[model samples]
Target: MTFEHAKCPLCLDQIAERSRLPDRGYQYQCPACGGPFEVSALAQRRAGKVGIHPGARAKMQQHLLDGKRPRVVFVNTTPNSYYEVREVNASEQTIIN
Candidate 1:
């Protein structure tokens, strides 16, 4: 299988995408951030250039520690924005606050 490469939105580390989760997003198990991240195409570009806020990273890390997945849509879009974290269970998906 051909692997697609991109930068982790949380850590900006060069990472290998495990799968294309439809549309223009990728799923990865990033080494730097120490977890899995679901990132959209545009979000990857933003992370590479503008970077993300420390608070945003902390949020994601917290979610991971609590056993949730971090779904990154955009980072620091307005200097106060952060990516979304998804809570997956046996049923519906939720957006963690």
Candidate 2:
């Protein structure tokens, strides 16, 4: 398996390979500070153009009290095309069409 390295924006430490989740937009969790961050390809390209940092992380937890977990579409455009629904977590009820 291959690995990609990126600096943790919060701790400024190089994140280890085990902490990366490539499929989910190159998301990573810093081992030192436990901060969640993403190093997106588009952001890298823009950073190359603008000469800025290429990664972003959630703000401090106290600042996230009003934030909501994004609703993700689990199933859409099925063979029958009868319904579309989103979910925030597994325990939540499924909103039907």
Candidate 3:
């Protein structure tokens, strides 16, 4: 949510050294005291964890049917190998390679 300057947990000084910066969470050391500083996810609302936006899922499905499948699907980096939708009455199946 909010990104503050990296602070040392022990002393609360802005960490200027490149090596001491935290990669993700706010858990770095205070330059003054060498104590660990931590950023809390609870301090802010996480993005997209609540639920999909209204009509987003339907639009995504429509886009997929239109052959605009994204390179990566779901939580994985692997591409979707295939996709198909069948019309029961027409007895037809459409496959996208």
Candidate 4:
């Protein structure tokens, strides 16, 4: 078996694949600070500072089910634009958003 690892930007802890959901997008919780984060293999980016609140996580999951990409939004700023979400494998690197 193989595992993917990422650093929790909030708690600065190393999160192992065991802590993540085994679905298409890797959703994980930081063991140290209990922060929620996601790594999108399609986007090839990690979204940090996502809320650990139940409602937030639910909303994110809903978006994923609806074929939307969930992005971490910071204070005092908003996403410039929205793009259609599409699934891409590791072998493909073209991203529209």
Candidate 5:
């Protein structure tokens, strides 16, 4: 998948590059503010399930990194909420506020 340009909402700085750690750690940082961004596996799973438009993952990651809550909308509402993810095994699967 093609990656989208990500910008930091706090500093409006574009994410230029990323470095992966040896411990299976991945982080994206803003060059201007040095804020580390997190890309959750749940978010990736959600993107895959919906076949979201290309570059959507990058945009969402940036939003989450900028301190905004990450959410995905689902079509089924009977068994679960529109924003629910089956991949999320528990309520704590999401980041705490």
Candidate 6:
């Protein structure tokens, strides 16, 4: 998490760069997946093993097509690992979790 860079957590694709968010997570675009996503530092470390559902990925794509960023909150704690996908307005700040 202290690292300045990271890869896409869902696809293992390289994230050329990442920006820190208010929640302490990072956001970056995945070249392979062709979209932007946010993940907590812990989820980033877990990589694809963090368990982002296929449906969430689908929603992300939809958000892109709608000119929005999928606000993905990856809660990867034991006993309740899950994804909470939301729509983000471009003009609004992304509150990543």
Best by lDDT: 6
Q: Model 3, 21: alpha-carbon shift in Å?
A: 23
Q: What is the lDDT of residue 45 in candidate 4?
A: 38
Clashing pairs in 5: none
| Full-model lDDT for every candidate | 0.60, 0.34, 0.28, 0.40, 0.40, 0.62
lDDT of 2 at 95: 23
Please, what are the lDDT tens digits per residue for candidate 5 over residues 1-97? 1233454322445653344323322234556644444334444344445543335444545555565543333344576633331222234232221
lDDT of 6 by residue, 34-65 (tens): 56666566555545554567777677667766
Query: What would you estimate as the lDDT of candidate 5?
Result: 0.40
- Kindly report which residue stretches of model 5 are placed more than 4 angstroms away from their true locations once superposed: 1-13, 21-25, 45-97
TM-scores of all models?
A: 0.60, 0.34, 0.23, 0.30, 0.28, 0.59
Give the alpha carbon lDDT tens digit for every residue of 1-97 in model 3: 2234543322224562212112322333234433232222321112124332223334433534554431111221366322222212222222211
The total of clashing pairs for model 6 equals: 0
Which candidate would rank higher by lDDT, 1 or 2?
1
lDDT of 2: 0.34
In candidate 6, stretches whose alpha carbon ends up further than 4 angstroms from where it belongs are 1-4, 41-49, 75-80, 94-97
- Which is better, 2 or 3, measured by lDDT? 2
- lDDT digits (tens) for residues 40-91 of candidate 4: 5432232333323344445555555565545332223265422222333334
The better-scoring model by lDDT among 1 and 4 is 1
lDDT of 4: 0.40
lDDT, model 6, position 5: 56
Better of 1 and 3 by TM-score: 1
Backbone N/Cα/C clashes per model: 0, 0, 4, 0, 0, 0
Superposition-based RMSD of candidate 2 using all C-alpha atoms, in angstroms: 11.9
